[model samples]
Target: MQEEFISSKQNAKVKNWRKLKTAKGRKQQGLYMIEGEHLIEEAVRSGVYLEAIILNETYEGAYPTGFSTYRLAAHVFESLAETDSPQGILAILGAQSRFNAAEDFQQLLAKPGDAINRWLLVDGVQDPGNLGTIIRTADAAGYRGVVLGTGTVDLYNDKVLRSTQGSHWHIEVVELPIETAMQTLQGAGIPVLATALHREARDYRTLDYAAGAPLALVVGNEGQGVQAKLIEQANLSVFIPMPGQAESLNVAVATGILLFAL
Candidate 1:
C-alpha cells in the first residue's frame, strides 16, 4: 500500500474531506466520515466498504493494512477533525441505504434460522444521542432490528454514530413509515405495544407472553411521548410506573428499561 501525504488544506481532496463533515455533503456524496481509532477498528472488523483511511503524521498506532491510506499534516488534520483529542486516524465509508422494503422485512422474519420477532419501533425520536443510545440498547437487549419512523433524527449523524459505539453494525436499522411497519407486524400476528402514560395503560411487568413469541415495542418522542393516534392503533399501551418525584425518565433510559421488560 502506498501512503500519500497531504500538506495543503486547500487541496481538492482535503476540501472534500472537510465537506463530509456536513449532513448535506454526506447526502450528496453518499458517504460518511468516522473518526477515532476505535470506530475505524470496528469498520475494519465488520468488512464494510471503506473509501479510505487517513492519519496524521504523528500517529503511531496500528491501523488496518491493505487499504488506501493517507498521511496529513498536523494543521490539515486538525481542520478536518471534529473531536478535541483526535486519535490521529479517520475513515471515509460508503453509506448504506436505511430503507428496508416491506418485502425485505418479511424476508427477515421468515428466515430459516433464529426467527426474529422482537422489534423496537421509534416514532419521531429527534435527539441524536437519544436515538443512538436507544439503538445501542436495542442491540444489547437482543431485538431483531430497529424501525425508525418519520421525524426521527438522521441515523447517520456523527453524534448518533459515535454514541452507538459500533452497535449499528451489529443490528439491522430500517427507516419506514410507522403506520406501515406497525400494520405489517400486526398482520404477521405480532403484538404491537406502545409506551405511554395513560389511565388505561398497564404496567409493563404484567405483560403476559411466551418466552419466544413475536413482539413489537413502540417508543415515542422525548417531549410528547407516543402520538395519541399511533397509541390508539396499538393493541396495548403500557408504562413504567414511576412513584418518585421525577416527571418522566429520559427517552433512552425509558426505552432500555421497557425493552428489557418486554
Candidate 2:
C-alpha cells in the first residue's frame, strides 16, 4: 500500500505524536513516540504495532509498504522530534506487551532455559535514559531476558525507547513486584544475582556463568543500589570488579558487563 504522507503539524496523528513526547501523554495514550531511524526499526521488528511513522522530508528510509507511514516536512518533524540532531525519521509505536506478575512469570521461565538463563532484573531504575540503555545492552549481550521490579522506569516511555535504539524488540522485559519476582525465579530453581556496593558481593568474574543454571542479574537504584530486602533475598551477591579510582560504573554499563560475561 502507498503510504499516505502527512506534512502538516496540525494533522490528527501528528498531534498525538506530540503528546507521546511527554511522560504523562504516553501514560494516557498507552503509546510512545520513537524519534530516530534505528530505534523505530528495532521496535518494528520486536512485534510492536506502528500506529504511524513520520519522516522528515530529507530522509529516505527503506520500510515495508505494508506499514503505514507519513512523510512530514523537515521543519515539522524537527519541531516534534526530541533528538539533539533529529534524524528526520520518527515513529509512534504501540507499547510493549504488558504483563501481570501472576500471568507472565510462568511464560518467561521457558525462555531463560536450563543452561543458566542469564537474565537482568531492574529495581527502581527511574531515569528513562538509563533504563533504555540497560535494555539495549541486555539485548546485545544475549541475556535470556529482563525482569523489572517496582519503581523502575516505564518501559513504554518515549525516552526509554529512544535510548534503547531498537533493542526493545529483542528481549523480554517483565515488570513486577520484587517479592513476586524472587519467588518465581526461586520456584523455578534459578539463582538470583544482585549487585551491591559495600556488602557481601564477590568479584563478578569469579562466578561460573557457563554452568547453565537459570540466573537473574539484578541491578538497583541510582542512589541506593538494590534495596535491603531484595539484597538479602538474593542467592548470590556479585560486585563488578572496578579497579579504577572512579566510584562505580553507570548501572547500564555495569549491567552490560555482567550480561556479556554470563
Candidate 3:
C-alpha cells in the first residue's frame, strides 16, 4: 500500500470529512464515509463504488483492489472517525440512491406492472435510526420496495446507513408524494394497510397475510402516528397488540413484528 500520512488536520481531505457531517455535503459531493471492515465489505459486495479507501499508516493485510488507497497516521484516522476506537480503515463511497416515494423511486417506477407489489410506505418518519431499521427489517422479511414520503429522514444519512446493517443496498427506496404512492399501489391492485393506535384497529397478527395479493404496509410518524387521510385510504387498519405496560412499541420494533406476523 502506498501510504500518505498527514499531520495537519487542515488537510483538504480531512476537511472533506467534516463536510460529511452535513446532509448538503453528502448530497452535493455524492459521497459518504463508512468505516470498519465489515461495513465496507458489505458495500463492496453490493458493488457500491468507493471514491477512496483511506487507511491508518500501521494497517496491514491484503485488502480488496479497486480504488484509490491512502494511509493517514493512525491518530489522524482515529480523530476523523465518527466512532470511538478506529478500526484501522475507512472508505468514501459515492452517494447511493435513497428511497424517495414521490418523484424518484426508480425500482417500482420503471418496472412493469407485474413487478410492482409489496411496498412499505413511510409518512414523515423523521428519525434516521428508526427509518433505517425499518428498511432493514423489511428487507429481511422479503418485501418488494419502500416508498419514502415527505418529511422523512434523509435515507443516506450515516446513522441510517449504519442502522440498516447493509440491508439498505438490497432494497429499493423511492421518494414520492403520498398521494402518488397510494394511487400507484391502488391502480395495481395492491392493498394498503395503515397502522394505528386506536382501540378498534385490527391486531396485526390477525390480518390475513395470505390475502395473496400485493400489499403495502404504511407506517407513520413517531408521535402523530399515521395521518388521518392515510387511514381513510387504507384497505385495512391494523395495530400491534401489547399485553405489556409500555404504551406502544417503537416504530422500528413494531414494524418488524408486524412484518414477520404478516
Over 1-262, each residue of candidate 2 has an lDDT whose tens digit, in order, gives 5666677878887787788777789878888777776676666666678887777878876653566777878777877877688877777777777566655776767553422366788999998999999988887777767788888977877688778777777767787887688778878887888888666778887777665556787899987888988888989888887678998788888887887776
Model 2: CA > 4 A from native: 2-8, 45-47, 58-63, 110-116
How many backbone clashes does every candidate have? 0, 3, 12
Score candidate 3 by lDDT: 0.79
Sort by lDDT, top down from the best: 1, 3, 2
Model 1 clashing residue pairs (backbone): none
Per-residue lDDT for 226-260 in model 3, tens only? 89888888888998878999987889988888877
Sliding window of 10 residues with minimal summed lDDT for model 1: 107-116
Name model 1 segments beyond 4 Å from true: 112-115
Off by over 4 Å in 3: 98-116
Per-residue CA lDDT of model 1 for 1-262, tens digit only, reads 9999999999899899898888889989999889888888998898788999899989999998888999999999999888899999999999876765787777666665343578899999999999999999989988878999989988878889998988888787898888888888888888899998889999988988776778999999989988998899999999998889999999999999988776
Clash total of candidate 3: 12
**TM-score, one value per model:** 0.94, 0.86, 0.88
RMSD to true structure for each model, in Å: 1.6, 2.7, 2.6
